[model samples]
Structure formats: C-alpha cells, structure tokens
Target: MVVVVGKEEVVVVNFGNSKAVLCRGGLAVPLSSDLKGERADEKGRCDDEAVVGRTINWNACHLPPLSTTSRSLGGEYRKQYIIMEPEVTVMKRTEQSDDFLIIATNSLWNVVGDKTACEVVKRYCVNGESGRLMSSDGSSTAAAASEAATALAVLAMAKGSRHNISIIVVQLK
Candidate 1:
C-alpha cells in the first residue's frame, strides 16, 4: 500500500505478504494497508503435539500460524496466511526546500537498519541540491533502491537463503 498526500504523489510496490506505504502528512495516514488473516492463527491455540511444535513461534508472538490463507495472487503461497509487513515512507513537502526518497524491502530492512537506509539515500542525492530537494518520481527512487537490494539479496541467495523484497521512494519537493 502506498499513499501520497499534498500536491506531491508517490509510487509503491508490494511483494508477497509485504507492503509499502508512502504518505505526505505527518499524521499516520496509511497509503496502503495489507492485513493477513494468518497472523491470527499464529495467535490461536492448537491441540496436536506435532502441530504445536510447528506452531510454537505463533504462541510466542501471540499470533496464529499463517497457513490459513491458501491462495495468493502470485502463487507464492498455498493455504498460507497473509502477513502485512509494511514499509512506510512519509515525506513532508514544502515550498522552501523539501524533497525526500525512500526504498525498502523485507531483506534490506531486516539486514540494513533505518539509519543505513537514510544514509544510502543521502549518498545518492545530488551534491548541490538541498537534502530536502529530491526527485519527484518516488518510483524511480524505489526502483533504484530495489535494484540495489535485489543485487544484495541475489548475492545472499548464492550464499544459501532467499529473501522477499519491496521498496518505497519519496520526494518532498
């Protein structure tokens, strides 16, 4: 889910059980919302011992297992619950000099902290432009960041594990 407020707009891409939201207002207005029912099952209580072992993490988190949702739009899961792990980008656009960009993915967010993400964006910003004066097309930022994250993920996958990804880009101008 991606929301852009004010005169400016934003672009978002959501993959799998993950979501990205872009908003202009400081108030928490979600541009996109994805709630997966499977979260509840992981919160529920199960009886079978074998099932219990598999569902233990759900109990720890006070959520049910995510296997309840059977079908997904991209055929990523069968009978699996949908989880909305959201990536939110809030850009406060102003007349003086306000431009910003955000790109995110589960893997990137998981490995690289928010500070690192901010630093990456800062590094990409043009030298002369004010920090706030960023690109208007949030999509381009998202695309660039996603590409970087995807490259990283591919390298990680080559090492062994795979990761799901999503990105959000914002410009404050």
Candidate 2:
C-alpha cells in the first residue's frame, strides 16, 4: 500500500490485498480497490480464458502457490493474469469532514469491513480512550495512532483472520 499525504490532498495507490480507507463525516470511504480477480474490473484485465472463468482456487488469480493477487508489483508465474500496475485514488483534504486514514492488509480486511474498522478507530481515537487522538500534542497523537493500529490488529485476529495483519492509522483531524 502507498499513500501520499500532501498539504491539500491525499493520494492512495494500492495493489493486491491491501486497502486504504478514509474516515469522512463519521463514515468509512474506500480510497483503493483490492486487486482481486473476483472484482469485475480486475477480472476483465486478464486475457487468460481459464483464469477469467475460474475462481483461482483461493482468492483471485492463478498461481495459488505464489499469491491470489490479480495485480502485484512482482511475480513471474502467470504474468499475463497478475499485472504489475496499481490503482490510484486522489482525494482533497476536507478538514471539516475528514477524521483519519486507515491502511491495512487483507488479514484485517478479510474479517473486518471498512465501516467496522473505521468505527473501531473512531471509538478509540475520539473518546479519549487508549487511542485518544484529538490532542494538540504531536506525541500524543502518535501514541493514539499506535494504539488504534494495535486495536485494529487485535480485532482482526479475534475475528479469525489467518493471514498476517498489518495496519497503519493516520489521524487527520
């Protein structure tokens, strides 16, 4: 997952199972689409007839041994189906509505929906709880982000995700 945070906007670029979500107006807004063969757009990108028709066994593409990602930065097997290109999304920063940003792997996303993840972060970040982020100090905010990330990872594990969970929480407001 790649996220570029500018002074006025934030750009998200992603491939494979990772995602970038923005919390706006107390709601979760997805910034990048998971590059899975199950998605119509992703499936249409592949020219292979077999991969296009079949469900790739596990998640989304051919080569179950390598990965289920339809799009990846590097992978030799089934190069025709697994493209290297990534999808990009750009959004203007709205201080009034935007709250925070969440970037996580499939391990977390497989069991947790975007809204649920956002709610979890909000619950900790806004309530002066372990993830309390609404502070003027930078260090406190950093601590909150860490706490929020840990909470998300724990929640994903509790929900029964077998994959490796990685999460990053960025407080915007």
Candidate 3:
C-alpha cells in the first residue's frame, strides 16, 4: 500500500510485483520492484538457480511460484528459492519535483509504461501553464486526485489490463 507520511514524503511498501512511481512534468520514475524469480536468482541474492542464465521456464521465468500458490503450494519451491519480502521505497517529495504519484498493480503496467501512464494522468492535470500544471478543478486536491485516478483506470482498462487493476493517483500538493 501507499502511505503519505508528510507533505513531502511517501513510504511505499509494495509486494507481489505491484509497482509505484513518482511523476513530474509528464515523466514517471519507478519506485518499486517486480521481485520476480529469475531476477532474484541473477543477483545471487537467493537460490542462484539460473544455469548460465538459462533455466526451465516453468518455475524460473515466472515469479518463482511463491507470490501466488494456486499453481503449486508447498510444492517444489523452497524458502531459499524465492524472495517474498516487499520492496519499500521512501520518496521525499521535492517542491520542484514529482507533481503527482501513481501506485498500481502489475496488471496496469503489463500493458502500459512509465511515460505513457504519466501522459495519461497528465491529461487531467491540464492546467496548461505550458505543463507547469495545477489541479484538475480549481476546487480541491481530492477532486484532482479522483479525476486523475479515474482517467488512469479507464486508460488501463482500454489498454486491456487482463488482471484486476488497482490504481491510486495522488496530487503532490
């Protein structure tokens, strides 16, 4: 989940391949990790299972069959075979950076990208000012955030997110 601790800081404790990002001026900077199986093995941080960077796709290509158990629970997977801890990123909001933030699951990212998502969200942050931006409606931050979130959800749906999409857009005011 995403937690806004203070005016200029957010702590994102993300898990299960979900992701987070900080956006500024139509660009998105990722703040979370995928925590997939092959990735973990490559870093030698876990059970280095990759044999010359090549392993069977069944249990190697995916997220180590640990994040989810429907495929196989208490099966061949050992504790050392996967990393289940969430990747936490603490972002200290800078007045000059990150106009907003988007926290979403992998479903959305599987179809969209950083810049594209930022652009989609920027559609609602349309204050003009040559992209300097202001709230969507000059009323309240919540309105802007809601509109941006809706826009993102709609766009992700349109882009065909297969899994359930969970998204939150926060205006970094």
- Choose the strongest candidate by TM-score: 2
**Per-model CA lDDT versus the true structure:** 0.40, 0.78, 0.62
Model 3 — TM-score against the truth?
0.69
CA RMSD per model (angstroms)? 7.8, 3.7, 5.2
What is the C-alpha lDDT profile of model 2 across 1-173, one tens digit per residue? 78998879999988778999999888999998777666777666553567544445544355444456777876565565576778889999987678889999988887899999998888656543233474334457788788888899999989987677999999886
Across 97-156, the per-residue lDDT of candidate 1 in tens digits comes to 433444444444445444444544554445554434234354454554454444545543
Q: How much is the lDDT of residue 20 in candidate 3?
A: 79
lDDT of 1 at 24: 29
Please list the residue runs of candidate 3 whose C-alpha ends up more than 4 Å from where it truly belongs after superposition: 38-60, 63-81, 128-139
Report the C-alpha displacement of residue 112, candidate 3, in angstroms: 0.6
Which should have the higher lDDT, number 1 or number 3? 3
Pitting candidate 2 against candidate 3, the one with the higher lDDT is 2
The ten-residue window of minimal lDDT in model 1 covers: 21-30
* Candidate 1 structure lDDT: 0.40
Off by over 4 Å in 1: 8-92, 95-97, 130-161
TM-scores, one per candidate: 0.43, 0.83, 0.69
After TM-score superposition, what is the CA distance of residue 88 in candidate 2 from its true location, in Å?
0.8
Which candidate leads the pack in lDDT?
Answer: 2
Per-residue CA lDDT of model 3 for 2-29, tens digit only, reads 4555676778776444677788645788
